[model samples]
Target: MGFFDNLLLNLDASVTGLFGQWNIWTSLLATALVGFLTYQVATRQDPDTHPFLLARQAQGTAVRQPGESPVYRSQAAPHGMLLNAGLNVKDPGASKWSRGRDGDLRDVWRQAVAGVQEPGPTKGAKGRILTVLGAEKIVEHNLDDITRQINLIGQHIADQGGNRVAIYLPNSVELLATLFACAFYNLTAVILPFDQPDDAVISMLRRSATDTVVTAPGSFPFDAVVKNYPSLRQLIWVVDEGSKHMDWNEVPQGTGGSVNVSTWQDIVNDAPLDAGKTLPPLEGQKEPRDVTVFWQSKPGQQEEMVRFTAGNFVSAIAAQIFAIPTSQRMGPSDLFLPADSLANSHTLVLTLAALFSNASVAFNSVASQADDLATATGGIAPTILVATPAALLKLHTESKPALSSFIGSKLHWLQTRSLTQKGMMPAAGGLLSSYYDRTVRPALGTTTTTTTPNKKKLRLIVTAERVGADTPKLSSAVLSDLRALTGARIMYALTAAKVAGAVTQTNFYDYRVFDDKCSHFGPPLTSTEVLFRDTEQYKTSDNISQGEIIVRGPCVAGMEAALGVAGKMREDNTLAYV
Candidate 1:
């Protein structure tokens, strides 16, 4: 062979032999270098030009659809790895399901509609979409209803000049409808976490530039919101207090005094559900890209507002990239288990993704109680499950006896988002192994089938990790171990305390700040750049170290309090006061 080829082979052999019996640390270092070299070589080699050598090697791919913006392409590359894995293994020749229309949001709704069209075995008295609340017989909404809801919401926003409304309710069908309504009408929807402190609620409302606040009456008290936020000019509450005629008022009499009120029935009754058969044409000179939802965050001393542009929803990008060729093979009989918040969001995205692929989603609303999960999901025997470490831990701890069935049956893949520690990964792996042996392999009705074209391989994507390339304890050996456990799909995001405007990062993870600093402000396109002058003056990538991270991305609106908590910003806008 050539000199370089022989040299690489010898080097690999020597390193393997030397580190073979060494401590895990040394072994990890050796293994990591080898892995990195392998990755670099595989990545550099083109699939079409050097197909044989780099065939199975997975390099992260970015997903960019036709007519999509360059911003999207840049942001999608890292995430494309996960999407591609899911799509690559899916079956081909599946029946086509289409909403038969255009528009990003509408298309998602259409896809959801198409998924509900397939016939499946009825679990209860009647057939429908599985819900958490006591709605036994529930299925996806029809095309007509979806279209009307979109138009109605859009009309309301058009009438009002930039109205800001809050969707204060639990995760239910109504909540879903409210989101679509907000998007359709082009009204800004501020999602306030119901579980947060009362002060946090007031702060979010004021920071978001909220003019109108909408909440489901009795869901939570609004004394704090009315008392603290002066920007709120209108208050609309959906009161479902066993009354025939719903209340719609401009002035609501409460502890905070007079405010407007609007009922759910009023909007529904007034909306022309059957008017325009198709979706109303997108209005304004700006396309979906101009639609921006502002987020309230800290940039230094200033409270900067970053708006998430349209068509940049992380879920949309994920759907396009993970579209499976043979996904059309399955009809509506499929079921899905989404246990975590992000995974649940993915389930919602999958509803859209399945429009191109032909799979149905059944909610595995497995109760916290293991027995409840077995009963709810066993009858349908879901083919896909999206979960997190906490939920999986609960399952393992509670369902020791039935664990075999839970693990060995129906679970095609395990997707996790929030990972606090590295030690927890082993337990996750054991759970997966047990799950495969007990549920997945048997449920698919195959033993010899080690791989499938329609199903993505088992790979974990770790988001927001603590120890990274910079951590003293983090070594090549640890990285190799992590890769060996979860494969090469381990993802790391190094977020800054405050940043805006999107920039290309050249490493595995960006530099991270401490706790409660960097919050997600939509897709990466909205991120910015920031740097401290004294602590971090050098612009060169080689000199980056632990200084108060200066963020400069589109999403870095400004510092929530430059003079208060995070410290003050320099004259040039860098956060130097920290």
Candidate 2:
């Protein structure tokens, strides 16, 4: 008792002596420190997603193949539950209690044209489609105008007995309208890459057995196309306003009258003004025709024609729509732009999702090219952007020199800290933002300009890695820097040729930097599940399973596909390429 009391007395004496030595300034300093620490603790926020959820992103089946790991699925659809199949299309006058039909591509257009129908009395307005050239807005078309074009072009093709139509134009309104027209008119649409050579285009058309082709005037050798493609019976030239004066309907002399040629503008002009105000009624059509994609695994390789059914496309579109969190899902107010080529399955599916959600869309011909992103997106602001890894890498490399400066370095460090350490995105547009823009952005030539009110609206960037394509690898550090620089959350996806959308995509809230090589692709999409096939070198093990990626689900083109790339599941259950 005596010893304990003495120790307590000594401690009290020391505390009193320490307090006695403090002047008013020292007492104020101590109080301020305590108050600041309390405020920090009180105001700290939890991460957007719980760590527990990240730790177990996918669920594994109990039974497994002898040499393979248990099949893994997104927590959204686990084990025995069916993966997302198709859009639950509810038609007008249908019983609300009945399960909706698995809709096709035609339903996608119908939903877009019908606009948003809220529960309230007021009806939502339809979204517009804009065509942009370099930073300039060339033209804006309303939903009615697009529908009119679809009707005219689709009727013209059907009248010509066109069965398979190849769309060979750039990212233009014509390409989009034609795709939808094919859906409504029951024609198979073959989407060909715009950057292909004339010979490659001819090869793809020959392989696809394309009966009709829609291409830009003067872009390809008309003689070569008509001569090479014997099955091609019709050629529809999409002429720009600048070249509308020129006659593009002239067939090559040797091809004779075997092939019918027409101009898109003439077709529209000859139609009644009131045409295409309503979608063509589906009398006996139960589903839309298949849409084929020309998949080029690598440069100089023969393209493989991958056919996707209406169910396949709709399933992927629906899955992508629901992938984002509810709070961050796209809506009628959002503006979406595909900076990458829509020929990419990932980008195509996302664009369709945007249209289904009634969001405005813009197209640029320079998509997938080495163009300045700032200049490409100058005229309008996009809330969501889908780009390729190369485009983003260009932006990252260009900003490096600017970020190397003292002010840029400090701001970048602070913002990165906020993103990685604090699980928060630093707020944009303040004195610090203005300072960085003035000092840093100017140094980045032609890629970014001074911060604009519209520029700050970019919230999400969706990019992906083709499993076997020879593209630059996007490291996690680069992605983190991109997030800090652009102030947008990035979702990196792993896409395979046979998959409709993607095998797996990172969560929008996943901002951790795992390594300098490749970022982790979160979990399998709701429409698909992932598994690993054992190889001689890598096998399924207790600690970690690494092998070839095998995917199976409704989103897959053939219901199952084996990705040739090697991958492993991380401790956090995220998918990463080996």
Candidate 3:
């Protein structure tokens, strides 16, 4: 008893001595530390997705090739189940319980016209189509008028015996309507890059075996196209409203009646007033024709024609539709704009998906240019913007140097913490944002002028890196910086030449910066599976599976394509090029 009492007494004495030495400053400091810790614990947030889910995002096959790694697929499709195949397009009057057929491009227009169909009390609604003329002019087209144009164009092409038609115009109402016209009329649509040189355009025509050509009046060398390609049968000139006063029907002197020529405006005007009000009747159950795209491995390389069947495109569209969580899926309330050229398959697929979801779409003629992103999206604010890595890199590089001021740097650091540590996007603008805008943005010079309008309305920025294209690399740190600056989430995709949409895309909610050099492309999409072909130097048995990437799925042009680039599968099952 005496020993216990003495020990207690000594402990109490030590505590009293420690407390007795504490002054007002020390006591205040201790209280502040305790309160800060308590506040932190109370305000902490859960990550966007569970960590375990990220760890095992994809599944591996039980068996593997002799020297290659086991095939990896999205968790959405396991070993025994089938991968995503098509859009599951149900025909009109088909049983609600029956399985849908793999629909063609005609069905895409039908769905857009049908509008949003949902259960319960929500009524169906259609989305508008907007065309940006320039910084000051935006035109909204009526669906009925667009339908009329489609019918006139389709009937004209079919009557002229045009089989394979090349659409060589910039992104405009005419381009979209002509594409749909070909779909409805069962003619193959060949998409050629609008910016190619005259010789390049002629070469593409010969290579694609295109019988019909649709383009602007003065865009290409008309005489050269007719002289070099004897198979050309029809030419439709899409004259702008400003230049329609000039005569565009003049053909070369020696051509005679062999080549039939027409203007888009004349075709629409010549049709009866009530001709194209309603859609043409479905032509029974026949499948639509193929859609061909030109693929260039790099600049100055010969372009190759890649033909994609309706099944390939529909499957890719469906895959992209379901890639996002159901709660976050696009709907009628959103406006989607593709700042990149729709000639790129990835951009085209996403645009179609947006249309299918009943979202408004905007097109700009300045698309596909690296430095014209701001000019393309100047007036309207889009909820979703799809662009190229070059465009985003330009934005990042230009805006970075302006944030060197002490206040701007501190604000950037706080925003970075919100993204990196908290897994949440910072609020778009606040008092601090106003202060930064006035002080820091002025230093940005012309960059401030080129900044996207109403940036606060932007919810997502989708950009991709073509595998073999000569473009700037987007590092994870740069992506993090972009996220901080834009106040919007970014989805970085890795696309290949043979894949319809994308080989793999980063998770929407994944904001981690894994490496400073290259960001990891997330798991294979649900529409496809990926495997690495083992090489002598980089084998599957290494710490990380490394080799060439092999992709296979319905979205692939040939059902399987080998991406001729070195890649590695990380421990977390993400993919990154070596």
The Cα local distance difference test for each model comes to: 0.37, 0.82, 0.80
TM-scores for the candidates: 0.48, 0.93, 0.92
Runs of candidate 2 with Cα error greater than 4 angstroms are 1-17, 23-32, 120-123, 255-257, 429-456
| lDDT of each residue in 28-75, candidate 1, tens digit only | 898999999996676342221222211211121233222211112123
Mark the regions of model 3 whose C-alpha exceeds 4 Å error after superposition: 1-31, 93-95, 120-122, 252-257, 283-285, 427-456
Model 1 RMSD, rounded to 1 decimal: 14.7
For model 3, which pairs clash? none
Candidate order (TM-score): 2, 3, 1
Number of the candidate with higher TM-score, 1 or 3 = 3
Compute the lDDT of residue 469 as modeled in candidate 1.
16
lDDT, candidate 3, equals 0.80
- Model 1, residue 230: displacement in angstroms? 3.1
Please report, as a residue range, the 10-residue window in candidate 1 with the lowest summed lDDT. 465-474
On lDDT, the candidate that comes out on top is 2
What's the count of clashing pairs in each model shown? Answer: 70, 0, 0
